[model samples]
Target chain A: MTSPTPAILPERGLADRLTALFWRHPRLLLAVLLTPPLLWLGVVYLGSLFALLLQSFYSIDEFSGVVKEEFTLKTYAELFRAQNLDIIIRTLVMSAAVTIGCALIAFPIAYYAARFARGKWKAVFYLGVMLPLWSSYLVKVYAWKLILAKEGIITWAAEGVGLSMILNAILAIPGIGGNSLSTSPLGTFIVFVYVWLPYMILPMQAALERVPTSMLEASADLGASRAQTFRTVILPLAMPGVIAGSIFTFSLTMGDYIIPQIVGTSARFIGLAVYQLQGTAGNIPLAAAFAVVPIVIMLIYLTIAKRKGAFDAL
Target chain B: MTAAVEFLRVSRHFGPASAPVKAVDGVDLTIAEGSFFAMLGPSGSGKTTCLRLISGFEKPTSGTIRIFGQDVGDIPPNRRNVNTVFQDYALFPHMNVRDNVGYGLMVKGVDRRTRDARAEEMLALVKLEGYGDRKPAQLSGGQRQRVALARALVNEPKVLLLDEPLGALDLKLREAMQDELKALQSRLGITFVFVTHDQGEALSMADSLAVFNEGRIAQIGTPAEVYARPRTRFVADFVGSSNVLPPEVTRAFGGPMKWASLRPEMLRVTAADGVALAGTVTGIRYLGAGSRLSVALNGTEVAALLPAGQPVPEPGATVGLAFDPAALHVMEGEG
Candidate 1:
């Protein structure tokens, strides 16, 4: 059989010609494919980050309340002042608490979903984790606010169950407590944990899924009892996912102004401080400096986590 | 003396109760102390499941499992005193080779120094003395396999279970590891229960082996005995290439009217004259060491293994096959 020559071959369509051209110059096709997302990342995301960083370097004039465009460490030095330092510390503590809380609560749920949930149960688990996320964030926060209020179902239930004294005792604690549950740091914390839990659960579930059943079997077969196997094998293997989940919870809690503003004490968080300073107070440099705190904290956190081999599993 | 491991009519089922998959069914087995025992079968033949039952990973539905004469009912895998070298060599990827090897000791609350020393010693035993610092991911497949072995052995369990430990290796590496494994088992004097699908691996490494079919043990005996005289068609067909003859063929060869097994190597193909059985040569396959000649006889096909340097017969030619009368093994039941 004689093969058809190019002269007698059918003409190629535009799509075919483009495919042939792409097949010959693969790098050109890659560049074409990557251009849109690369531009979005480089210009919009990183460009804004660089602008914020540059803004943080400039200082606000004390008397004129005007931002000086020149680079100076004066605005950064202002961050060391007692009142501003209080907001930073408070935000840091809350972020850590929320992250730890999310982790503790998410682990068992994620473990159950990863190791046991199958077919219909798996779908139900995913729905349970993601159901709250489908609601608007502000709506969820406000709903939590109502749930934690003085006349809310929790307080009523506690009273009905003869546990109101315990509830009152918890609310009577100094810095976290307020006149009502809606006006307490604990309420803010509860809302924050509730908001960020799904983020924690999904990553943790994915990490736990990657842990082979054979690994657990091997560990048990080696004479490591259930608790020992959990400590040495399961926990260490799940650390990366925990760390990944913590990144979301920690950073989100740090930057959230709305939750604290609506629920907590009159004292402010870093996000609220940044909001007030940049808007009403017109201290853009200080606001930018406040925003940089979570970034710097996360950098240190990631470094420590990496050293502990958290990303190794990831 | 009590067997190292014993199963009394164990059965394990999976999925729904209405029509469950019987992974293992009514299996009774015993492994002698300090013996290298292999469970030989194809995939899903229940050999691996039986190994898991011994290791306490899977519980038997209807029977007791005794390890070292102790009924291990409801005892978890960790307390069973048997360790498994998983098929995929499930060495902890997060830990270094030393830590992985010493995990059992560490979990037992042995001090760091003792764990380190014992781990290093086990690594040396596996001929991987200097590779302790590397992660499992850092090592080659065979190295990881050795680490898994060291990890399991460091526990010093009464019985060691290997689930196709050499299945992942290449032919050369697998053969070398098989010899090393046999040597190690004898030297340690620990009971070794190995599982494999490869008949050659089972025949070579095991002191005694069981042939599993479906979910039951078809036969169990020493390599030589099983190879020379398989009691069933499945054993003869699976263990090695054998010419299974029907009852009519057995009768034609002046044997009792029963199913029979004839080893391929026992038959000699010649010109179709004055022979016990005559057939047309259907196929000739070169096997480097010898040739396999398939002959159609008595309404069924039989193969003859021709040694190297023999004159090969062409297909479509009628050939006579000769074998000693005693070589035809009469099986008890129909396949």
Candidate 2:
């Protein structure tokens, strides 16, 4: 047998050689394919993070009103003060509350979508969940402001239905309560829940979709009640999706400033504090340290969630 | 003896009244206690619906269903003493084999120690003793099937419903599982109501099988009775591969019925006459078990299953195909 030249082979080109090379050395090709994105991540994302960390270590010269590039915990010490501590704790509490609330609300909507809603009704339910997300986030936030105002339809309906006393009682509670639904932390929370709800519902539906109908039947066939089936079979399988959604609701609520700035009254949230410190006050070291709070909290969250296999579904 | 499960004119329909799909149309059946019963049918033939009705996953549209001679009309599935092994194996993906197996016990509020011990026993019963800690995803198709069986069997219900549990496995695994299931059912003395579209599996494993066709029972008899003297053309064709002689051939055979059904193996091909019929070989199909020769005669064609070792006759080869005069089973409709 004679060795055939590229011309003699009838199908010869650079593309052919590259294809052959790729087929022979897939790992090398994979590395080559991935390098561009990895380089982009390394330089653009991780590099900026590294720069931010370096800035946190550097301190500002108090007397000269200039940032001095030196390693210090003075900014962190400032961050742990009573006022800063209150903001951090408040943000944590609200995020946790919003996450729990989203879970409680999203589960039924997601369950209805995954299990019962079929054909045209399923499309409608799906559209209802996602339609709010398609509109402008700010528009939705401002819309909530009008809906929750003192003389808004909510208060009017509550009053009209003779539930004004109950609504007032709920609003009169210490931290969360306010004069009206709007112009309060309650308003901010409602808006945050409204905006980030689809994030929770979508992952939950996707997760529930992976659960087989036969498993439910099998559970019933095995003498498990409807409640038992939900607890034993359905809930555990759908946990990763819930956690994936909680990551969105929790992190988004923790880092939000616009909702608070618009609706809240004199409340200094973490995001608002971070914005004021970095953009207005021009305290790079302190602001960098302040910004690290959410990053640190999210890091801890992701690490624990990863350990629980939350990222498996995500 | 009291029936293990009984359905009286059970019917389940779907869609609008104008054009409803009668998934299980007015079928009556009684599953004997401690017998291996199979509901065999093609897809959409309501064998699955029969199994589901037995399991209480679905309620009958109008008819009454009984279990152990008790009217279980209002009883939910959890209230009924029955368990099912789903076709897809339906083992919980999140739970280990032990947890999945022990779930029924756990649901009954049995203590953890007892559940674990029983789960261990069930695992051993299925020959998966050391695989308790493995998730359903980690197991192979055959292993998953056994796990599903073990899980359902762990409950030790009066009746066990299997919806083609071995269908997902390959041929060898399926055959092995079939024997294993038959042995297990006999050993345990539980009423096994298995459903499958595979006629061979039904014929081999079932002590008494119900042949279902289009939301109705075509025939309910022992495998031999159904295979030998099927009452309907559908049953004759479905029980095993049969050569259905057309009306012309039936007329030739001196039958009054519209069609005559005979097993391919019953027909003998020969080079000499003095047999039942003469035909020309038109096609030869080499099945691994045996060769099938397609013979054509007088605008009618029939296939004969010949012995495996013989040289198949060439196309247009003149041959005689013979069968016993009484071997032909005549059918009334759809010749």
Candidate 3:
């Protein structure tokens, strides 16, 4: 019925009382605010990574098609072989090309949407750019396959328009052949660039949107030409977005196996290699080792991008 | 002096023919060289649009704009010898104060040494000498504004366009910056085209002012001329506080009018025996320097400002007021 007795303790100062208060409401303190990310990093991301690293240490026997229990770096050692290294290098080059291509195309589109387009058209144009992103990525790549095939709509239309001879001649030149675009690595690269273009565009649009139109006006007012405004003010302000979008395009292209498997005849990417080693050969250790190549490349990319303030664009 | 900037029959419209919004409708104005000019209006009254046209942020739908005697119809904004301090300042957040102020020079291919020295000089002029290394975000509002001014001024354009540059600051800071801007404009001897919706801002800083209404120039004059003799009801009501009276002119002295406007301070509160109208005090507001009393005179509300030490009329007390005839402006109602 009466109030509970107050706890008696040694006399303490304001600092000690403040610490005690913090301890009492620890949920209102630090840990509650930090728990979500801590759990994600500790349990999901790092745990899965630890498991993958452990698997990479096991050796795969060629004839038996079984993983050895004993710890070994043989799988990783095998990854440095000429064939595997070629796949790794090809992936890097293709990813870089796609990222650069996307950046080039996206910059103008984003600039137009941010600065020139007015009222409802701005939203409509941006939505058109983003609509492909919501659709299935696989479907979009598959659609490109049909368009690039030998008897595809594009080739038929080119022939119907009497430009097929010119197109065929260009395609027949040494490195580029008369064979269908679907049968070449260039086909895979084109599809990769097309499918992931929106990823680059949306972020660039967001970044360009953050740039005040006044800044561009200010640039022009200072006697800089339209070209100069783009180069100086617009380009510098949109750099963060460019880098951010590049990261997405580069990493996504590096790790994608589906487009290459469907559209390419001879091109072999690290992602396709990983899929082959795991799915067909039943060599989990080797596949895991191949996964490390993309992970390492992405880590290097992230470090460079972070240093350039790309994350601030988020 | 030659006109530093001039707009001849300039008109700008947006959207399709079925529904076009005329942002600037046939405005003809001439800004004198080395003078600070202000375009004042309420929002959507085309003040900012007019500034944009002069600054080359926008081109006229039809007509010509001349800067320092050059007809700049085909010349793009960048090629124009004008710079603008945008309403939001638009300082590059990624660049430090030095780089931001130096950007215009850098784009012109100036050497780093020359650009940096000039940028530092401008930074000092704006009283931001030590702040050259700080980013725009790191500086306070007033500091950012100064940096924006320095950036615009470093280009040494013949005309400087400011779009409500002091609108973002708090009251005290705004007043200080207003004076600073006026003094800066005078010292540089460069023509300034400033746009603001605040009447006080226009009256204080402008050497001459243009009042815009519905995308048209309503009137243009020096501050005192505009304040003393507004040509329209809108001008009289907008430029300052005035007691607009709706009166049937049973007797007329100069012009035809159904209403007249009188400045509150021009009305002398008097005893009931010697005044034209009888009124009862409705309310009183005590300002530090002066007190204002609201009176109901002939079924219309009239406000009069009195000295602070004057005796306050009670709310129900009967009172009389008289206004100087010279200070009264007769105006026609909106047709």
Candidate 4:
């Protein structure tokens, strides 16, 4: 081709050359940009997870206090032992309770923020939801530990309100009670729900915000009362958000060790069991197996949510 | 018979109490039973607000609203015997078509079998007989509109409110739905309050219509009366493309020195042969059926519609405009 009068082009520095290269082969540019994060996720995250899974398939030598390099179901069989099984069931029950509690507490706050609060009030809502997350998680757990103590403000307030008898009656209940609120399963549950509430509220608020105002009006126009409209329209439409929020609350509760260790009676949850088994007891295989339980439970939960059409809204 | 819905000087206001935005102001209207009534106006002109007031979605800031002779100002939408087909056709995404249509019945504690049968019947009425298994997401825009109609009609409400139900459809589908809706309204013999900004749809479908402007009813009459003898400059300007002539221009055209409306279709163009209303042709737009000629007369522009194959004047040519005296309808009162 014959050249025309030459037009001046910008000096092809590294940035200019890179831009030209990117324009020529977009896939190559994408690969170059994605390499760092992809390597981090693949090598660091999944690599450690693969190691854990491999360890769960191995057994520890009983007499030598050493991990055997042979793959066997002996470690898996240890999960069915009476003490380990008890810990699993207790943790499952606590996780389910905490998830349900978080959902109930988060829904009204989320709904108010989504549908009613505007401008400054919406800013306040977001600040209130996110403020706790910015504070130290251990600090909040410890604060709860104090508030729920035997001689804390709650007990003093109960006494001031002449409700000590009622409080005593509640503390007399079996299985959930200990010497006081701070050492009870109920206390642990309260802390779990409080800690995870922001997770549930944000996703639920996002879901609720997506629901059109016209839909509610249409339901009411069709002769459905407020309650009916809420049940038939609002709840169903917000299910995907609920499921999304529940994934966080449920999994977080299932794997939390701090709250149970610090607040509740010495009843070992799955997380505490995993912690103690790996560290104090040096039973790494059983700890790995215990860690796998929450992952398996989450997979089952997600599958059920998918089959129920929860993610369709998302 | 009592009016199906009556508004006694109703007004709805929003925003600050110090200086509120009057969405609907001092409006008195009556929708007759068994009539297809249209509320016609541009957006934010209070037509949709009026529909909401009747459906109890919005309460009047002042004045009384009556349904079938009873004052229903305090009543909620669920207690009112009316249903709305939303502009977006807000069908429930999770439910199948049958369940969505049957939701009202289900809320009323009707058995599944009977509500299902009624829903199916309603679906068939809207010509959607066997599409009950699909979710709303699976349906096209037109199909979703049909489902919304069926869902509202399944309740057999005394009053049916449609808020720009056909606004989202294509031209052909909108025309077909217009005919179908008109047929359904007459066959059912129930009051239907439809809201739209489209003048052609209002003229073709409504038994009677109220023309709204600036949060007030400019005029309310049969479609022909509203289209032909509009009571104000606003109505004449909004309802159809009419040349709104000022008092001086009206007098120049031999009118009684009053504000008047001259429809383009009523004006004729001819050579400037010593005609009184002579003007220079500024532009000619070729419409499919006819051509529109814009003529500048005494520095004011007036439009004339000439039928196809009629001789068209070139731009900048002087042309005479002629129209019958009766065609210049005099409007009453300020807009």
Candidate 5:
């Protein structure tokens, strides 16, 4: 003991230190790091889904006006009923038409912004396009409703400008017009597309902007013309963005209840049908079953989108 | 051969007239066919702008650019019979090597078989034959550079514009590639109008060179002509390291004499005294193959390069430096 005792170093092994760290304040660390997200995913998302799924399995007795917990395939069976299937098909067609229309319109605007527009003007132009997004979604949809109505400003202005006859002729085209602008399925489809067009354009503009200007110059230097550069260089690079925008338009059109509720009269979409089932008829199970249809369609869309590198764009 | 590229009194003014920045001001150049011509300058010296004007990327505000005797003022970059290898290489990242090389052929509506064969031939010429399927990201920087070369050369333009092609490579690789590029240009027999800020690159690879200063071509001559007898102080200072001593002409030295410029390598260090300036060695840098001495003579610094194993004077030691009168270049004051 008198011969100068050798100092011993403390052995703090990795596992031992980690164990001690966790043991000190296990609940506190868990709450700090994991509780907020766990509560959000577990309670908000999963709790609602658990109730909805439970409702999907139950049967509602129309005569007794009482809900029964007896699980059956009848609600799912009713989802494929002819009238319901028609609504599903109509929603898909409307979403496809809107996506195509948006892509055609947004491509040139995005290309011009990314390639030609310089300085503050590019930011101003992009901000102008995105300015519509900040406005209330309901107000925009309602504004469109007034514009397209028979006695609204657009029709009155068309008549005042002596373009009423031309407007009527254009509206009466086969598959597009049945009778008049306000009371047709095409009218509702147009309204839906107008409301959701911004969602498609923003993502597309972002994707197209990622293509370096040097790549385009390289293409031109290689003797490609303007049209050829667009086809070969511009289109392929913007594919991932286009697919992403399409997914947004498709899923939103499928799930949206308000737009179709306001504009649709003759042509009923699955979203409107689901709303009627849940709210008007009190057929929660049938509505839940119909909800599963759009989810399935969305899943298929997401799968294809993932395969085409759409997820990477996001 | 006739001039493959010519810019006559070309001036390009950007922005408003009141305070216009003349990127290239009144430049007149004629690049001989099949010659490796280098335009050397620092950043914003208008060398690149001149190249862009010739390549039809930018139009001259007041003058004309002709490619192979035809006016290219109204023509676009793709329409001009000249291709540019941009400083960044500008290879299409989405495309494979073969597609990138054959882009010009494909755009011209050549048959796929012929285009593919031509692409392969170009790839082989660049020694990148097996890298056809690989993207630009997969290749190393040097390999990517070669791919860029193959892509530009495959187009077979009347003139190829290289904007600092070797500026991105490491020192050793750049030197090797410089030799390769010189050999390639000769083999292809295509006129190359290269732009670079590197004096060594210009001197090593160029058949003739133009030194640009403040939006003007200060001097243009062959590498030897320019180096041996620089007309302007800017040219002498830019092209090589020089000890510009303020020496008054004690005697009339007739042939185009102005201020004296003595290149560091031209100054020989010797112990023998007569007909030489005496200076104290302020510093000595023993650079393995050779030694560089910083000598102070009359409060002015003069650098002298001496071969290794030659006795180098220590700091504060007196040394005699001598150079041939022919080696002392007379140059005009800086423009």
Candidate 6:
């Protein structure tokens, strides 16, 4: 028996035509999909960073003190001046201190939440960590300023508890201590740690959660002490999370000028100096050069962290 | 010798008091020293949970557990003289295999030289001599299993616990591992307590096996003994393939109780020999080694394993099946 030939439809739907084109050229389709976001990130965000870096290389005019369009290392050379170097060091030290403090405090909290804490308690802990973040950052910084004031609740409580002497003793230290914690480098460090702590805790909790209960049991079964198991099994495994959290603490502390402005005494941090240079002094090249310090430091830090396998956990 | 591990009415309950999930309920077991013991069950039968209890990972809701006559009820898992090979291997992903294997030694403050030597020795023992420098992610699934075994065995604990260590491997690789584990256990002269849902693995590898059924041990005996005689209905069905005769079928020939079980291999079939129980072959399955004939007998069906090269009968052909009196395993009690 002869079968009748069927006629093919000539007109193609838009979706069908696009699908056919995509099917025929998958890589082109992928490029089409990814182009917009990649274009946005590459041009808008990274383009400014690249431009800022280029601006750092321009020379500062000797007489006019204005940024010269000519490229030179004069501004970069000024970065090594003693006072500028001192501010860089101060910022570095503070960033390290805040990162360490955040890690120390965040780890125990994350450990408890991930391994042992139950339903309602886990939610409570999560809310406690996250709830503070919903408030304005400036508000929290100001609150810390009030809390650390000479006539603040902390000093009053310290005095009431006969701990004022201890507080004064702590305030007498050379670099970190000052008249009052509100007017101290120590207070800035504390505020930085407080602000970035949630960033530390969440990553730590996630990393700890990925650690199988079986491995912990395995460690125990192998005749290791509780401390030994934690040292050998838990801590080494949690390093990635610590490194990830350090990224937050370190970068946040390094870049923030606001906390130092409200809470610090006489010390100038990298961010504050950079702000003064760019805004008040109109030394864009020098400010950009100073800004390159944190960027360079973070690049080095991320490299070291990557070597230590931090991104693997992420 | 005294048992290496003992569970005295152990039970672990989770969730609210009103309706707790009984992961392990009043389990009393004695594991012999230097023997390969298996806790066999289907998923959620509490075998792994029982292993956890023995390893001190979980506290029993009631009862007590002892290791080498010492009560370990209050001991944390790290203090226990037992090592576990986790199902997922649980090798430290951050550490090289040498470090992973030697972790317990390092924890004990063993010097680096001694730890390295022992880890090296363990690597060689698992046939992964050069794999010591590699990471867990760098190794294949089977190689990772070996690394886990080496890690647990390196500690030389009183007993080693393996939680479905072979569950992740392919069938061919799993078979090879089962033999390796048996050999390793015997050579090391260490008590091994492993859990698995695979009946064939349990039967082949266990010196003594316990069948777990819904948080309780259904039966415990040697592989041969359990297979020859399963004491409960659950065991008769779950331990291996068996034709569980219905009450009507048993009563048709006045054989036994409301529930009786017969191993498929134990039954013999004949086309026209006019055996006591007569039936028609409803279905025929041609397995490589032998064939399984599904017979429709008096309101019930039973399976009989026919040897290869037999004169096969077509479907719907009349047939007769017979078995020895001892083949009728009376499945009694609530399993």
* Best model number under lDDT: 4
- List residue ranges in candidate 6 displaced over 4 A: A1-13, A16-20, A117-125, A159-162, A306-314, B272-275, B280-282, B311-317
lDDT of 3 at B129: 82
Candidate 4 chain B has its poorest 10 consecutive residues by lDDT at B268-277
The digit string of per-residue lDDT tens for model 1 on B1-335 reads: 66999889988988787997898999899999999999999999999999999988888877888998899988888888798999998888889999999999988899999999999999999999889788898999999999999999998989999999999999999999999999999999999999999999999999999999888899999999999888789998999978788889889978899888899999987789988789998999999999999899878889899999999988999999888889999887445
| CAPRI accuracy category, model 5 | acceptable
Cα lDDT of candidate 3 equals 0.84
| lDDT against the true structure, each candidate | 0.92, 0.87, 0.84, 0.92, 0.83, 0.88
Give every collision pair in model 1.
none
lDDT of 3 at A103: 93
> Model 4, B1-335: lDDT tens per residue?
76999999999999998999999999999999999999999999999999999999898999999999999988999889899899999998889999999988998899999999999999999999999999999999999999999999988999999999999999999999999999999999989999999989999999999998878999999999999998999988898878999999999999888999999999988779978899988999999899999999988899999999888778999999888998999888688
* Each prediction's DockQ against the real complex: 0.82, 0.67, 0.54, 0.74, 0.47, 0.62
- Candidate with best TM-score: 1
Ranking by lDDT: 4, 1, 6, 2, 3, 5
Q: Give one digit per residue, the lDDT tens place, for model 5 in B1-335.
A: 79998889999999999999999899999999999999999999999988888776678899888888998888888888788888889887778899889999999999989999999999999899889999888899999999999999888998999998888999999999999989999999999999999998999999999999989999999999888888777787888877665544312222243566778898888773774477899998888999889988767888899988887777889888877778777676565
lDDT of 6 by residue, B1-335 (tens): 88999999999999998999998999999999999999999999999989988887788999989999999989888778788999888888878899889988988889999999999999999999988888889899999999998998887889999999999999999999999999998899999998999999999999999999889999999999898888877888888888877667766655764778889898888755657788999999999899999998876888999999888889999998878877787766554
User: Which regions of candidate 2 are displaced past 4 Å?
Assistant: A1-33, A306-314, B272-276, B332-335
Higher-ranked by TM-score: 1 or 2:
1
Query: Residue B53 CA error for candidate 6 (Å)?
Result: 1.6
Q: Mind sharing the TM-score for model 5? A: 0.87
Best by DockQ: 1
Which of candidates 3 and 6 reaches a greater lDDT?
6
| Cα error, candidate 1, residue A148 (Å) | 1.2
| Better candidate number, 5 or 6, judged by lDDT | 6
Model with the higher DockQ, candidate 1 or 6? 1
Residue by residue across A71-162, what tens digits does model 6's lDDT show?
A: 88888989899988889988899999999999999999999999998999999999999999999999999999999999999999999999
Q: Which ten residues in a row have the lowest lDDT in candidate 5 chain B?
A: B248-257
Candidate 5 lDDT over A91-112, as tens digits, reads 8888778778777877787777
lDDT of 1 at B196: 98
